[model samples]
Target: MKNLKALLAVPAAFGAVLAVSGNAVAAESLVEENLVESVAVESVAVEAADTVEAADVMVAEPIQLAQVTSVSELSDVRASDWAFTALQRLVEEYGCLEGYPDRTFRGNRAMTRYEFAAGLNACLDVVIQLIGGGDLTDVRRLQEEFAAELATIRGRTDLLEADVAELEANQFSTTTKLRGQVDAHLVVPFGEADGEVPLLDDDGNQATDPDGTPLTTRDTLEEADATFEYRARLNFDTSFTGEDRLRLRLQASDSASSLVNAGGLASQSGRRNGFEDNIGLDDVYYSFPIGNRISGIIAANSIVTDDFVTSTIVPYDGPAVADVSGPVFYDQFAGGNFGAGVNFAFTDNLVLDLGYSSEASNVNTDDGGIFEEYSYIAQLNFLTDGLFNAAVTYIDGESDELDTPDYTIAGLLNLDFGRVEVGGHYAYSPSDDGDQDSYGLGVTVPDLFGAGNQLGLYGTILPDDEDEPLVVEAYYQLGLNEYFSITPAVIYADNDSGDDSENIYGALRATFNF
Candidate 1:
């Protein structure tokens, strides 16, 4: 029978080599008695192959070691010495010494003969259950002195159990997580392109054509051509208490904005264009947390007020486009599609926010639900830890189909410096038929020609009640890595009238993330 258990483990390997040679002669140096005789001879050769097995062996679940009852609770073991009384008698009389669930006992580095044979097979399974049946002859003489570190820790624990069973069989959710993005674009439009510019409305006036002539921009850039457009999204996000989040997203688009058919040259590159290309559910939030300086959100569908601000301290609000990205009176008075919001934090650089949206919160008659066509907001952020920030908003919309109720007021700013930044914005709404406004200013720069490159430069005036055109833009981007990017851009517009107004455009975009 295996040579009669190797001749009855030669008197239990001569009583574990005389109890590790009396704890390495009560160690006090010779390098802690050669580190307790090289961790009890590499832990009796990992418990002499614990009764050998193998075919499909996995073996990984190990860390749960806290046992230590005084090697002075090992925070780097000490007590004036080399192996303090042999780790306080193998940690208080055979408790099988342990430490390192951060209780650390990393006695000055270097271990790894497969972590000293997994700490000597956990002190030989607590000294073979405190000496009741031992005779593996010091685990076959430390399994012939560490048989190649226990076969390289069982072939790296069977290749980490076959890479954790192929990542739990190709995991795609254990509480959601998707994320995506696309973009594309192309656009063109160049200076007046052949005159006839007129057709304006949405309060920029001049719209005629019912035989009444005047509706032109050369027939809307000869029927809006030179295009390409695209968009895509995905998101998903979910979480169930890692401090909340939910999201949803999904989307698709046609993404127009080749100067939005000319007339006063509309452009925010058509602000994420019209989803007429299908795939829906554009957003449906949830966000959470409410004690530790508040936080909240509840969207139910595309909402916006910069998603309850905490900083709109613009920076071309994410690369720019014609309307200098934001503050067209907060997208004409704060967004909608249902909403709710919060944000408190009064410090760590201030915050306050608040929100409410509803372009018919899912509509339901009586002039449609949720306070009919609403919008509300409030802001105040500030933030800083260097690189300045700012905010200040207020809104209050209403629109029984525009029967009036506007009120707006906005502000934002940013600064940076360390390769430029500077941003700015301003809005104003006030309508009794005429007091709208908008503003912008930008600069960016950022690693200009390399590292996630960028460039930008802007100017604006856009929100009008009559003649506010004036735009200007420029772009660069060019990331090309962590999932792509391109950009290009250039715009111009004018419409201060006085003869051939003005126009120009050109774009490129490209993007892609995942």
Candidate 2:
């Protein structure tokens, strides 16, 4: 059957090839025939401008003729070239190229309008191709569909093309001038659980509790204590001169109601609170280029880290046996206060970041009050085929409760393939006698459903001491379209305590970006 199909395709393929060749030859012949002829057409004569040179030339006719004629009529003919006419028209139509004066229009000198419309058109042509427009045929088809518009600019196609080129020249600066992104998600949990269990995933999915039990919306375990299951993140960044920049990041999440009992560990939410209220930062900072290879950041209140940050879509901290500065422990290390730092890029692929944080006792709350700690943080980051990062931080001074830990260390590594990403992190708090370790693996399949959408899978696991607890969670995102996605996830927790308790929770989420 395969051989028959191959044999049958041979004639059709050959015939198609021959037809394409014929079309190509026909096109080449037509193009040659349609070439603009350089015929000695009648010129649009004009009187010489009133100038002293005209008088001198009139008097020294022999000298003037010798000078002008030696330059050949063709060379002098440049004074009447079509390019000059196009430029003159451009000035008359668009005013002075934005930042120039009328007197600045130098027609006598050879100029490259390639930075104008011509350049813009060429760059756009490339962009349209990169964005999956296929090939030149697609562009021609679009032009054909908009034939009237194409026809209107046909006479000045070269100028129009240069316009795109000009835009392209500015595209880098323009895109770098100021940029912003918004990430928001609304997830609904639909798993069945008898009571509140620890959600295996900390990412805001209202899954089961740490104990092996299911959580539901109904009355059985409705009043369990937990942060809201919904999470939202918004960030904006602006870069000036492609170097110095400013950034503002915000994380917000809704509260969850769930109960969990692991060993002697138990948490019951008196009321549901958002993730932001529990473990996130609301910060703004300004970054300025310090030297040729260094930048400085001035932040009053910010979230600063030395490691590659994973998504807050989950509720658990990263896996670092000794996470000294983790949210679960510090809750607000370099956050909820003021701080500053410097980042140095020793090489194109290596970076060193150091920052100092001081608290004026602003983050005052019942959980942790007026933390009057001084945080010193440093991190060394390297990137080659993938990324390797290590960070160390020390907290001096005392919590309002006078229980500030001395130091924390964290390490992380990430390997990214075209569509797959795998990463792990470890955090340790030698002073507090607490440690955390976490790892995650995820993959994104592109163009699902033939709609240029994507499908993604993410899973992570975190395990602590014998009675400390273990968590596992997984999710799948099905792209509904270019700007929308539907994600469903599950979280499971097993409490190895006397009850050998387990809990499960599930969520269905929708996300949109602009």
Candidate 3:
């Protein structure tokens, strides 16, 4: 009876989760090999067992069977999960389930061999009982099909139980999980990818001849071989209340941007494909639910343009799109700010957003500090039945003109047509030095050549005092695997920066995600 108690207890420890993972089969097979010898020993002891007490074999505590409505109700299991099919059958037909006191099944928790065996044993008995009741359509057949596995599952439940007991006594952390993303990119620039252009200095003062000849030239394009760039980000998401999240993002990068050579309009890495050296805290933000339909964000470091904006007009905003592939009409907005913002859901498909950011918040003096280089943005977003989406935004910011302020009014829209998505944005800048307009149209064809393959074409017209430059770009994104992709793009520009500098750009970008 004592030996029987150990055997049954061993199986109870292993239980049902392992059944879905298929580890139970391996465990059962191992146990069956040992069972061949154990059963022989047991048969010889059966004559002595008749004199032994049945009390030694009975479990001290009753087995608790869970009342599960659906496999999706299990926190670790979901209808859309990869393990759904195997788990569904285990719950619906076997009726062998056990859950925590709270009713949630932590199916992802690891288990020892004994626990696996125990779970299998529980299911085996339920099936056996169903077969006897005559309602089991294939339970009997399945039981015979896995007879060896059943014996194995019952076989070394002891060792697994002991191992698990020891581990539980030494476990760590009921809260907190760590995740990370490392992205590596290879950017190759060709054709007329390097050149110099004119622009205002960081102080907002024109670094040019008063006669308009030119006081300075920014070499927008660099003449060099292909460059490799990489950025690594580690995010720590902590939650006290399940509905609130505090995120600390730490990042490091050693890459340079090729905005000019890549047919990019601005000198921003936001459009390019690299990062600066040294690790730094990129963002520190907290989000909490204000209500069922409202949420808010407060980020101290690395405030950005889209943090407050409700929707994006561009579809494929990703790495390597910096030069010619990204949303050109959105060039005037985004990046470099510190702020707090909120998103409001007026309905299921309508959202409103508001945010404020400061570029030089850390600088404090009579020079204005937090209010000196600040911006305020407001947005309204609307979507229609997964077919079309649009956004209207108004952004106000400090101007380089000392006393004056600058603002932009923009509209963006996206339309989905089966395998293709079309999107564009229009922005109008009102400034005394230059009143300008920018607009772009783009199309995305997913699965163009194969699964995960995408082809994109975009045309953009950017405002340039006297010259409106037109840029037409094309690119194809090829997925190599789950963690890697290759993007090859071509860009053609007419009247580059209003200088009539016509050029062609070819770029190959490869990204690896880890």
Candidate 4:
């Protein structure tokens, strides 16, 4: 069996009337205010009266907390950590918790009965609240059976039982982790049915949509797909913290799509032609901070400004709607990347954010050859009055042969008035290189049909009149419950080359926190 030591440390809040000054004082409350404060003072002190008295019940050595995986992880664990914080103080000042020399605490490992029992008793002893009501006989009997090992509380089984019992009574807040979700998609488009249209390719090839019967099969058109997609993530929380956390993000989306017909002709072309799809990643990152004033993260898909933006149709928001999808962007940054920043409150209606991330790269050979490289991105943001939010971003160090450009400037803004929220953006490339200018805008609100649900309406227009053709997109998402939702969306394009195009997309998903 796994040593129960790890499990014994779980938080178990119990209260008792500690006769103080001849009056009843809630032990839980007193510990919150006084015991914690006492430990915070410079040197640790154990008042003789406050120390745990030797009883038939045993005590255990303390276990140290784990080092956070990243800066963001640290912030998340700290926020919403009231009960855990109290426990931490008790363990630290009491010199009861032991950490491995390597410094890892293995906070999630399971625990045995003895270890759990000792931890419970120690917590109860320090809080001095478990003395009044419960029968001590059962606790004493259990401790004696494990006395050889429970002599000092270094992971005893009886204490573990008591701790588990207290937790089941809902004496504290700490959420338990349960399940996860995995997603995958692929999207791609190549042959334009219209001969006059400019093909959507990196080489600027002339598009050719042969004279096939006009696809009147459906109200919507589907683009060709090239690759398949995949994604997975886990969510969990402790009631004590009152905060939820998610981790391990991975996604790969196919780059092409197939035509869906609304009419009979759709069946005849069922086996028509399909092309190979390229794959891309989506925004793959973990978020875990709870308090309003502080939080941070380290992720490859980390976009400081994208967190607050409304639409992707705007030219400068980064890439055009067609060029950027959730999966493509995910792989573009690779998950091993790191970043750190904080949200600072200037006042009720104002705030600021600053952050930075390192770039990643790799090489693949086509027919023959070899190459190598790396990249980095940086950003700054400011917001006020729920009306305006502005951000600037820069991308530097893309390799030459990979066809990746060196730099681009991006910005995003949101304006809220009464019941409507409006958003806008712009992006520019300084060199004569790849992808020039882009821009977009959108709006949203609540209870459009007089129902409890919210309603969102958004639209984006991208690319300056001169270079890249214009592309427009719009979408709406309705929340049906805490874990279920539906999104309906559409896109249209009018290129300088003269071939007009349109697309409609929709999805319904059932989500739950584990």
The candidate that wins on TM-score is 3
Q: Model 2, stretches more than 4 Å misplaced?
A: 1-151, 154-242, 248-253, 256-281, 302-334, 361-371, 386-405, 417-419, 432-466, 478-482, 499-501
Q: What local lDDT score does residue 174 receive in model 1, on the 0 to 100 scale?
A: 81
All candidates: CA RMSD (Å): 23.2, 19.3, 17.7, 22.4
Query: What lDDT does each candidate get?
Result: 0.64, 0.41, 0.60, 0.37
Task: Give per-candidate clash totals.
Answer: 2, 67, 13, 73
Give the per-residue lDDT digits (tens) of candidate 4, residues 11-50.
Answer: 4322101101000112222333444554555354453234
Cα lDDT tens digits for candidate 2, 1-514: 4334334433333222222111222223233333322122323232222232333343333111111111122223244565544333222322112111111222244323222433234333333444454445665777689998877788588887899999887774553343323233332223333433433223112334346344434433333333224445555667776777677665554433432321111111111222223435455778788879887877755434322122221112221111211233233233435667787788876777776655553556343433354556666666554433333333333333222344555555555454544444444544353443334444444444555444444343333433444444454556666666665555555544545355555544455554
lDDT over C-alpha atoms for residue 194 of model 2? 46
Error of 1 at 182 (Å): 9.7
Instruction: Judge candidate 4 against the unseen true structure and give its global Cα lDDT, from 0 to 1.
Output: 0.37
TM-score of each prediction: 0.26, 0.47, 0.60, 0.42
- lDDT of the structure predicted as candidate 3: 0.60
Worst 10 residues of 4 by lDDT: 15-24
Q: Who is ahead in TM-score, 1 or 4?
A: 4
Q: In terms of lDDT, which candidate is stronger, 1 or 2?
A: 1
Model 4 spans with C-alpha error above 4 angstroms: 1-246, 250-296, 300-376, 401-406, 450-454, 462-467, 500-514
What TM value does model 1 have? 0.26
